[model samples]
Target chain A: MAALVETINLTRYFDIGRGQRVHAVDDVSLTIGEKEIVGLVGESGSGKSTFGKTVVGLHGKTSGSVKFRGETLPQSYRPADFQRLASKMQMIFQDPYSSLNPRMTVGEIIAEGLRLHSTLDSKQVQARVEEWLVRVGLQAGHMSRYSHEFSGGQRQRIGIARALILEPEFVVCDEPISALDVSVQAQVINLLGELKETLGLTLLFIAHDLSMVRYVSDRMAVMYLGSLVEIGKADAVYFDPKHPYTEVLVGSNPEPDPELERRRPSTAIVGEIPSPVNVPQGCRFANRCPKVLEQCRSVTPQLITLKDSERQVACHLYN
Target chain B: MTGVMTSPQTIPALLEVRDLAVEFATYGGTVQAVRGVSFSVEKGKTLAIVGESGCGKSVTVQSLMGLIPMPPGRITAGSARLNGVEVLGCNVINGKDIRGSQIGMIFQDPMTSLNPTMRIGDQIAEPLQEHRGYSHKRAFSEAINLLSLSKIPEAAKRARQYPFEFSGGMLQRAMIAMAIACKPSILIADEPTTALDVTIQAQILDLLQDLQTETGMAIVLITHDLGVVARVADEVAVMYAGKIVEQGSVDDIFYRSAHPYTLGLKLAMPTNDPDKQHKLNPIDGSPPDLFAPPPGCGYCPRCPFSMKICDSRPPENFEVAVQHFSRCWLHHPQARISPAAPSIPRELYVGERA
Candidate 1:
């Protein structure tokens, strides 16, 4: 199957003065197939969000190519090109409260996307907005309410409705349910899953919640210090994670079962994540990895595919 | 065993909360946040209060500590007795003394808990100075010791820096240091790890467990995450609409939950195993408005097993086991309720093992 979206060695670097640069994203290559949900899982400062933003054209790529439907994205900053792509690709931000304009009513928020992407009349827009509101499990009366008046779950529903009303082929859901309550988190996840199937949408679900990402995504990718550390089928990545970083991430999650929790192995990774500005020469996870090799401190490991499997791991052990 | 109660152990708990009710007087109306809630935490154990947002878990704890503001909210009726002393009825001066010295609290957001302009060392030292009357030099050294205790790297240098200089994990460690500064008997941690990433959250939870073991302090952990509750809590209290729907040992709560709400919540959580394509069964309908609370079960509206009595009158908590209790009418004989209409769909209970 042809990929709906593909990034070829995409890199984004921030020049932090004095001939120094921060590589927020370094040589990341990925593909998103039609109607497939790809989860980008990592802790803070892993550059998953930066990668998502770069793909969606929110951030300009320093080097490399982004292709959408066989057409190469413009290298330079072009508003028209971005606007044209914006119609097909949408992004749901992390914080629904901050992402939405407080002054605007829920109706206006949902309609804004339609107005930008569609040439619908006022009545047509209102009907479409209502349709989306119901699709996201909200009532038509809620349209008049402000963002603050609604709960975190409702606000997220509004955000989802706004994003989906455009009927975008692909969406970048950046920690969309992180701020919500646990009970509501499930609702939002289920809603996203259902919507994906019904709308035939491709998703790049970015989040720190490993369990949730594992549950929802078909394929999962782990990021570390602005680079892909591991990528595989969701089951393979979660159950039999090869990379030490991935192992720690999976183990670190406190198991919901008390029995399992008692017997769960200790995570190999310990101590706080190192500063992004002072990234290490070799493995970024070398400082905290339990099985750190001498060569790990001096030589950066390239991501390598093992055997005939789709799983890719970046570590000296794999090398 | 000399001082311990007889078999089936009916000794008074470390903290006993009875008929606890709290209300907030807002311009919109009087919001009854908590209503006739009761539970207890044993010594050297952790009691997790689990609920969704606006379910009044935080409010119940805030009332216990007298942290609720007067104009906006007040504990109307309740007795929160800690070690046989009434905490709610105590004066502010006495409460302040008890707050840091006898009962410590860790709030949800560590960034907001700390002062931006203040040095990390001074913040940790403040509680010690206020409660212990230690001199500035002594307190500073004690602050560094506390930092080291939390296992922060280069504690002395980190203590000299400001809150902004610390990472989320470091700041949380600092918060823990501040919380345990006075060596309180009870530590109320309100979602301490919610804002942190999973790796940092795991580290912090481990630190909290270690601290609990070292100090033998009873912990009242307020959170909505069942996963967290399962990990740290010795006992669990599932709260809804300001009342405890279920309370039991961690094993019972996780494996053999009696309340439908508790069962639903467990089913809703996404399992870590990626191969399991378990469909999440989130409870339908939102939590009730506490300002005009329903007469019966607050969770009845969303509950699949809701009976007619659940919507009419509040169900009395029935003892299922020695300490396990649930407020659902399913176990009560007097309710004489039939199965829900059309019955809860089989798919809703899909991965639920018998």
Candidate 2:
């Protein structure tokens, strides 16, 4: 399989005043294959969103490189670089209510990409926008409606149509369904799946919901405190997680079955995620890990491929 | 009759709401937020109100707590009884005010709900001082004890810190400590753990269960997540368009859902169980507009099994099982066969990773 997007030791940091820096993404490497969906899951403040944003050039990388289709992207995106990459890469933001311009019509919002990246006239762009709207299960008449007029689900569909209008090969979705209601979340996920199939698009799906991510992705990666702790096949990582953090995470995720939930023992992790600004030494999850070893508090583990298996884990236990 | 099945025959409910109707006078028109919703909660039991956003789950509880603004929001019709004493339509209930002393509430976002200017301990103590008439020193000491009960590490040290000093999970623990400070009979948690991570969410939910067991207090948990509802709820009320579409025990709702909307919700969720693998059948359309809600069933446009009567008039609650009721025309004896609750959908990955 061809590598669609590759990040080699990608790191991003925000420099606060007083010589302090928040390590949002720290030396993380990941690869997304052509037509493959990679789900990235982590708790809030664990830097999953920052990682996605850094990979898509929404945030400038402090170090390392991002390679798309074997070509390296700029460390800091300029207007020219963004313009050049606009048609090939796109992003679906987390909050649908705030992502789209409130003043613009749905048609104008969807057609902006075409207007910026292509030579299409207003008529041509409007036609394509209407077609894409219908493709995403919305009516052509909805193109004239404002974002405020639509519900959360409808606004999300509009966001998808806007992103896909450019026909990008790779898309980074940052918690696209987290803000949505539970009933409407499935509709957006199914829509993304259907679109991925027809367009043969590769997606870097970033979300906090584990079950939904495992259901939609080919592979899953777990992050904690700006570092990848586990990456493996979706089913394998979910059902048989190797890393201690992943084990606790999967165990703690609540299932929708009343019998199973009531029957299972409580698997809550002990403490909150350590502050990313002042990241702890050694393994980041040691404070809350039930299976923590003394060495886990001092020695930072490297992501290594397990022998005789395709899974990669970063933990003292695995080592 | 509105949700008479909600009142079980064995024991009297600690909190009972009947024919509850609430509306907001918005700029567009009157938004019938809670349209004849009714349910009851017994002592030492949990009743979860589950629905999509804007479905009136929050409104129902807010109206009960007398938290809604009077001018913009009004309780058009309803009767709330606590231990057979009238709780609604009065400023006070049997010489006991209901808001904090009888029914305590914890909101979704702890940061926004908490006072940034006040210390965590002071905030928690405020309720005790105001409701229980405890002295400042006594309330402060009890606040530390409550924090410890919430499992906050170094409770004394943490209590003195402001809300900004606490983490998301810790802040929620502080919120829980404050809500139960007065040991209210009914605790209303409105999406308490929705803003926290799954790991932290598990902790908070476990703490709530432990607190309920300890105090024998009834809990009204309102959330949109079925997973949380299944985990914490003894009885579940599914709401749509400001109405209780279905009400039943957790098992009855999950395993033997009789309403089309309930079945649609189950089918839409992605499940890990391999035995139920199939494509998810998502509900087709968004909920009806509340400014001018549909004259008939609110879920009719989105229900796959909608009937002619569903579009013309709302259906009455039909008893499907013991203490289980569904408001749908399909549950009518003269109607066609009821749709079975689809088992959880198993997701199959179609692509091979590199």
For each candidate, report its DockQ versus the true two-chain complex.
0.65, 0.78
Measured with DockQ on alpha carbons, how good is candidate 1? 0.65
Q: Please, what are the lDDT tens digits per residue for candidate 1 over residues B131-227?
A: 8999988999999999999989899999999999998888989988998999988999999999888888888888898898998999999987777
Interface RMSD in Å per candidate, to 1 decimal?
1.8, 1.1
Error of 1 at A109 (Å): 2.2
Q: What's each prediction's TM-score?
A: 0.94, 0.95
- Candidate with maximal DockQ: 2
State the lDDT of candidate 2 residue by residue for A110-215, as single tens digits: 9999999999989999999999999988999998989999888889999999999999999999999998876778889989999999999999999989989988
Error of 2 at B146 (Å): 1.0
Q: Write the per-residue lDDT of candidate 2 for residues B1-354, one digit (tens) a residue.
A: 233343334357898888899899988899999999878999999999999888999989888877777878888998988888777766333333767777888999998999999999999999899888999999999999999999999999998999999888899999999989888999999999998999999999999999999999999999988899989999999998999988989988887787778777877778767455556777877788898889999998887667778888978788777888898887666787436523333223211110
Global Cα RMSD, each model = 3.3, 3.9
Q: What local lDDT score does residue A181 receive in model 2, on the 0 to 100 scale? A: 75
